[model samples]
Target chain A: MNHFMTSIFLILTLQFTGVSSSLALADDSIFVIAGKNSSLPQITATDLKLIYLGQKSSLAGKPILIGQNESIQESFYATFTDKDMTAINQLWGIVIFTGKTDPPKNLKSDSEVIKFVNDDENAIGYVSKQPEGDSARVLAIQKSTTTTSK
Target chain B: MDLWKNIVFSCRLFIFCLSLATALATSVASELQINGFGTVGAAASDDQSGYAYDIRNKINYYHDTKFGLNFSSRLGQKWSWASQLLVKRWVDDTFDDNKVKLDWALVSYHPWSDLSFRVGKQKLPLWLFSDYAEVGFLYPWVRPIQEVYGITPLNTITGASLNYIKQLGTVNFELNAVAGDSKVVEDRNGGIVLLANVKRAQLLTFSLIHENFLLKANLGKSDAVDVTQRTGSSSYVFPQLKYTFASLGAKVDYQTHFVWTEIVTTHVEHLSNMNGLYLSYGKKFGIFSPHITYARYWSHNYKSVRADTTTSTATTTVRVLSYVPERKNKQQSLILGLVTKITDRSNFKLEWQYIDADGYSRDTTERSTTTGGVTTTVTSHGNTKERGFFDAHPRGEVNLFSATINFIF
Candidate 1:
């Protein structure tokens, strides 16, 4: 009886299928990194939230953006920013449907993010581990990240 | 009337121009992005009188179902173009015959980080979520509060808008101005539909957006030209309409909880005036979120005109009898819902609503008397039929159950 109930529960709950990326795994620590040649501002947690939410693309310098939905560290990065990948996607859905801006580019791996940031002086992305070899510079979250941005 | 007759021609001309412009734009563009959203919903209502919210005694799986596709491309750092195609079933329209409506097809130019100019087809920016109301996954409930959101039919327009974004301390403020014309299609029967042409439609919206908070104000005005549709021999019972509306909205969003509310007042030229408000609250528990809302809509300022002529002459005296039809549409409801986030792009939601409404039916009658060498007629309006907001005749109240699977990619 217990096994039958478990099977029924699984059938009911796991039947919903979505286009999920295999790269979505929550990591230990996430860092917001940009190109070393970029003149990024002291972005608060709120400002970073706005960037991920597709509200603000730039601050002080050129525009900032997030990695694509299929990014390997997207879940960890969103969690570090006090958000979930679903929440971020919902917000971007609103902005994109309004024709305000396009969705993020497909950066399937952290190494791709680091490479893109290294090439573009205006680009920004998040990674699970701290980048090395002066490839990218991690900006300081000016406000305390312990508390949620909102 | 002429504009209504020439709607097909106008739409063709606009489509040609837009296609030409897109061709010119894509000639220099190299990247194209496609995005879309869809919802499959089923709803049921227990109402003995008639249908309400498109739900009758049986389960309805098509009323709330919809699909949308948006294609966008960037021409350069300063120019971009976007267009959306939508297919959805509506009340009075059968399944497998949903109309493919062009929600928006516009080109945007951004010369600065804070300024943007767009021209073409755009959604009227009336309320906070009115710009993207079709995306069911973005809202807390199975659908937006129908009491307030269903007050107008001018959903999309073909015109131009200017947006100016500014930053003030900790808040991001945006001022949006829209000017255009719209043709709203109103479905009356399976074959007969009313087409209303809105002229000189203008709207202004001011929004202050924060990471955890939002405040918005909107003002809009429009005039409708009479255009009746005829297929075979059926005609619509639509009136020539005009309206002006003003609204205010606020939202407090957090990772664990959210509170949202909006209030609006609308004054119509020949129809009834109305006021509506809805307050919603929701809290998250891991993958499950439970939400609740209280909404109320009422119509007042019922207009009555009195004209008296000579009813008695010579040797006979006549008594004047008047009857005026009462105009009303009112509703109040409590909605409870639950949402489960199944994945980053999909969600499952279930909702139950308890609604109380009145004033949707009326009867027209006239009293006339002939005296001496003249004839007199007295025209009046008022009847005693209590029809609810979503039903032809309900059993005083109603209970509705709904479920949907929403997704975007």
Candidate 2:
């Protein structure tokens, strides 16, 4: 009886550890990044929402160029905009089809996004992890009711 | 044959211009973007005498099928150019002649981050979805509720506009003002086609947007020439007419639930007064979303006068004849729809609508006349007999079912 109790405790401990680690892995954090020379140091959640919705054209009196990573767009939009990828695309269809504004430039990977942002002084982008580029800086996002960020 | 020749010529010219623009943009601009959206849809109605516009009992694709292409070029920092071309088959018989048309062509200048100016042809921003009505992938319904959208006869105008956008904390405010002119054509059962030339059109819109809520108001005015009497080789030109409209709209989205509402009133001088209302609610669950909408349209105090002229060898007389006064009509519809996202770029939608219309009559009139050397003589005339709204379905109720596949890239 003592051996059986010890084995049951060990199994429960392993199961809890495994579940927690998987949750941590699945909870990938998204970061908003801008060019090193950009005038915007940080962005509020409302402003970010407006920019993505094509309701605002700039931040801090500087023209904004938006870049997107195709790989993480689904998760990033869901987290930041509270919208799925399909919803985001539909919104873009309205904006673009109306000739109101152009959509963001789509890049294949985080490296491409980092490169695009670094080349354009007014550029902004999102990524799952911090990019390995000195020319791009991660802009701290202000906490707000509409956005969730890490 | 002449129309076909003209269509071919127009197509060739458009192709040549497109190629030229592409070459110039590739050589000068750093980037050019081309995008397109299309809908392949079919609809059927249960009314034998037809229902809602020109739809009949047969499954029809021409009434709602449409495709559009957009081209945008970024010119330097302060300037950009955009153009859109749309091909649609509408219910009107005259639209069959011009299936392909230019939707918008505008050159915009952004001198400041919050302000911009655009000049050229543009969509008349009257309602919430007016700008992108043909893009089926954007909206929640299979189509915009017809009762509200059908009231606006003009959708595009040659115009110049100024737009201002400002963000304050959690609220965003936008103002748009436009001045333009347009020509609208309407076909009345292939017997009479009215051409309206509108001038001095002006519109103003204000919107306040929160994170998930939006409030909008619009006011517009225009002067138009009623050219209906000139359709049958008549040289007489009617006087200029004036019209004004005001509308309010609101929308809310919380979690997976959404609601939208709009109300509008229009006054056409010496013709009629019109009002419309639309309400919609929807909820999203994963890749599937279902929505329901109710729309109503009412016309009050419709008035028109008909004159008759008779000529003989001895006398030519013109008499003031019958008058239609204080006529009223109303149409209401309820729609239930389901939309499913098949992929990132494709969507499939199905909708069922029940429509009830009242205060309308169907009539047929016949006139026989004889002409001699220099005088025309009136021989006989038959009066029009009023009948019910639907000959086959006497209740004036129609059921419409539609399915569409929409895609964007």
Best by DockQ: 1
Worst 10 residues of 1 chain B by lDDT: B301-310
- Write model 2 residue lDDT over A11-77, tens digit each, in one string: 7665433332222214666778887776676887667777876667787897788888887666667
Q: Please give the TM-score that candidate 1 achieves against the real structure.
A: 0.79
The numbered model that scores best in lDDT is 2
What tens digits encode model 1's per-residue C-alpha lDDT throughout A29-136? 556788888787656776776666666777784544455425443454345456666777777788788887656655667788887677666677776567887888
Local error of candidate 2 at residue A86 (angstroms): 2.3
**Model 2 DockQ (Cα-based):** 0.34
Task: Assess every candidate by TM-score.
Answer: 0.79, 0.80
Model 2: per-residue Cα lDDT over B301-335, one tens digit each: 44454334444444333332333344566778899
TM-score for chain B of each model, two decimals: 0.81, 0.82
**Whose TM-score is greatest here?**
2
lDDT of 2 at B359: 66
Clashing residue pairs in all predictions, respectively, total 8, 0
